[model samples]
Target: MTTHDPIPARLAALRTTPTPELKQQWRELFDSEPPPFNRRFLESRLAYRIQELVYGGLKPETIRRLERLGEELDGGDRKKSRIRADLKPIVGTRLIREWQGVEQLVTVTQDGFEWQGRPYQSLSAIARAITGTRWNGWVFFGLKNHRRTA
Candidate 1:
């Protein structure tokens, strides 16, 4: 006895659907404007949203557990958690940037970063040292843009 599952079909259809149609579906399903992301992002998120509508979202207890885990990972700092997960590079990864006429190199380390035989806590500090003015390190290093969504 097999039950008809429309989810797979819906998910598959998203891959071939036109961008405008996908945006329409997103507006209908999410009750908001579609994010200005790539076609692949729209398709994947639409697939997830389709499944979530059919099967429901995470349970409250599960959400609480995840929150607890996130708190533990970031020492109760939400901003730090997001930064660590999204922006922090793996240890030993070398970040290179050229300013003016000289090339700058910074190495990701276990504690923080190492640049020019010196240890620094944050990339912003390194960026400031490289340039006289204040700057957002992620933007300066091209890891992120100035106009971030969240």
Candidate 2:
């Protein structure tokens, strides 16, 4: 059997300005959503609250206090968000738009060609392939590569 405890000690350590009635307020809020927070949408609720806390001129202090409590909390670390579709495919692959503004793909950054911004780590692998003269289009084109080294 498992037992759960009310988050008192953790909340006590984060007492920024006393709101004695705050527990009542929290209880009322919990009464409304008794399922408890365990989803991305639930977390996003606290995200807005935390963002406001940071913007309210308590970012550093909040970070410190939260770090203390986070050491005890299980799911304290935030998850990384996924980039949009446009940036998603291009994360590890270098693509380009031709005169028709279509994305033309290339296997390697060929000689005498110039690139403005860095694509991704795939750039390093492609560069290494080109320099090492082991350039293979079949290996790179539309291939999901996992290199233990690189």
Candidate 3:
């Protein structure tokens, strides 16, 4: 049989405790003013802290690795230019457009665009095939527009 412990009772009380009481507990336990988080968040952190005091927190190496990953995610450690949000497309994404009652389709590839089982250097080439006229590939594919023409 499991023994009753004050830790579980405290955790239960923490959940039902008012926000102002939890903030006071937070200050007493953490020795600092509690953040302006909601009551549930406050209770969760306090519960984790209670367990951490009995057990332990994560290792230093694990903490460092997590911090490094967070930095990489925040773009703090990137060497190369970030991919443009507008140009980013996973391979196999389909681009479809209808012109002259015909549905034109193109598949995005790692290297470029593909149409009709043949790879094209640019969307403009596919657009030219569809319309037989020179056109900006991005504009023709509805990806962008001729906003800044020389």
Candidate 4:
């Protein structure tokens, strides 16, 4: 015996499928609309992931602001969410690499990814091309600035 339900109800029921199937479905859902919200979420997730990898003592204020922004957005506040819209790496994440070496020194705070000794124009530009890969990793290996440097 088959029972028919309203279209909305049927669609909602079919939407979830199951956990395993939901994985692919979820991918499609994100891929279809990887925009401001999704991009921010992904970037936040990537930031946290990279933080875990490097174990750098990121600025507490920075972390707090990011968390607050994410929370506000997840709560459905589009305005606040838009503030974090710039987080997404449109191309991909990059590591600060030296101009002539495989080793990455660390990013300089001048708005570009820094490598061994030279700074790149931007993360996306450095990566050249982007893939759906969760950001590779990052190191807090910043330059040592003496009082004189400042």
Candidate 5:
């Protein structure tokens, strides 16, 4: 017997829904003002919320396990957890940028970053080396927007 699955349709509709309508839906679903994030974020969160409402959210044990994993990743520090979740790239990932017609490459490491045969403690330092001026490394490397908070 075939049973209708409405969750897929609900998720698909999020892509076409207008931003204001999505915000309204967010308010109703989340019981709060919609966050000041982009339309994509709204759509994605709405999709997840719709499915979560129908299928039930994660189990308490699963949630606790995820929290423990996050703590492990950030050494049990909430501030560090947020920063790492938002800013830290996977180790060994290569970040490449072009400055003054020269290509610069940086490798993410466990401790920091490696660039130009030298290890650096921060991407801003590498950006300074490449541009000879203070620059937000994430912006210079095109990893994130300047407005994003850690």
Candidate 6:
């Protein structure tokens, strides 16, 4: 049951195979219907599942060590570590936007955002103040984009 070649070959083949063939491979390997995810998701998960079968999954101790490394890199605090690294703006970074023909500037401080020499808790607040309406700060400043529809 520990065949390495066909598993990787199948995983690789998944990239070029049509959806029906991918589902067939899913049935053969997992003995269940594949989730209705896109081709990339199916291929990546199936590749990992194939590898998991051929070589046993990661050891618990190894997983713990990796988690510890991640925590250490993310400022050693669990709360900070929980924040997505991409979402955090580096200290001293300046954000600028134009609203109503006026340019607004915000500076990223160690604790929060500084706008017009005033400390604010969240970007949405700044966006609301600038636009005189409710707006998602991240979206307004382009930190985050709206999710794409399938």
TM values, all candidates: 0.67, 0.18, 0.46, 0.20, 0.66, 0.62
Instruction: Look at candidate 2 and give me any clashing residue pairs.
Output: none
lDDT of 1: 0.90
Off by over 4 Å in 1: 81-84, 96-105, 109-112, 116-124, 127-150
Q: What's the C-alpha lDDT at position 136 in model 2?
A: 35
User: Ranking under TM-score, best-scoring first?
Assistant: 1, 5, 6, 3, 4, 2
Off by over 4 Å in 5: 1-8, 84-88, 94-106, 115-119, 127-133, 138-150
Best by TM-score: 1
Show where candidate 2 strays beyond 4 Å. 1-4, 8-39, 44-90, 95-103, 106-150
Candidate 6's residue-wise lDDT over 10-91, tens digit each? 6677789888887887898789999988889888877887888888899999999999898667657888777766676988
Off by over 4 Å in 3: 1-4, 77-150
In candidate 3, what residue range of length 10 has the lowest lDDT sum? 77-86
Per-residue lDDT of model 5, residues 65-128, tens digit only: 9999887777797767667344679899999887889899999987789997889999999999
Residue 128 CA error for candidate 2 (Å)?
Answer: 31
lDDT of 4 at 27: 53
Write one digit per residue (lDDT tens) for candidate 3, span 3-77.
Answer: 776888888888788888889988988999999877788999999998778778899999999878766654663
lDDT of 4 at 121: 59
Which of 3 and 4 is the better model by TM-score?
3
* Model 1 agreement with the true structure over 18-99: per-residue lDDT tens digits: 9999999999999999998999999998888888889999899999999998877668865676674545898899999999
How many clashes (backbone atoms < 3 Å, residues ≥3 apart in a chain or on different chains) does model 1 have?
0
How does candidate 4 score on lDDT? Answer: 0.45
Whole-model Cα lDDT of every candidate shown, in order = 0.90, 0.41, 0.83, 0.45, 0.89, 0.85
Compare candidates 4 and 5 on TM-score and give the better one. 5
Q: Model 2 clash tally?
A: 0
Q: Give the lDDT of residue 98 in candidate 1.
A: 97
Per-residue lDDT of candidate 4, residues 19-102 (tens digit): 444444335544443333433344444444334444555689999998887776557566545654554333334435443454
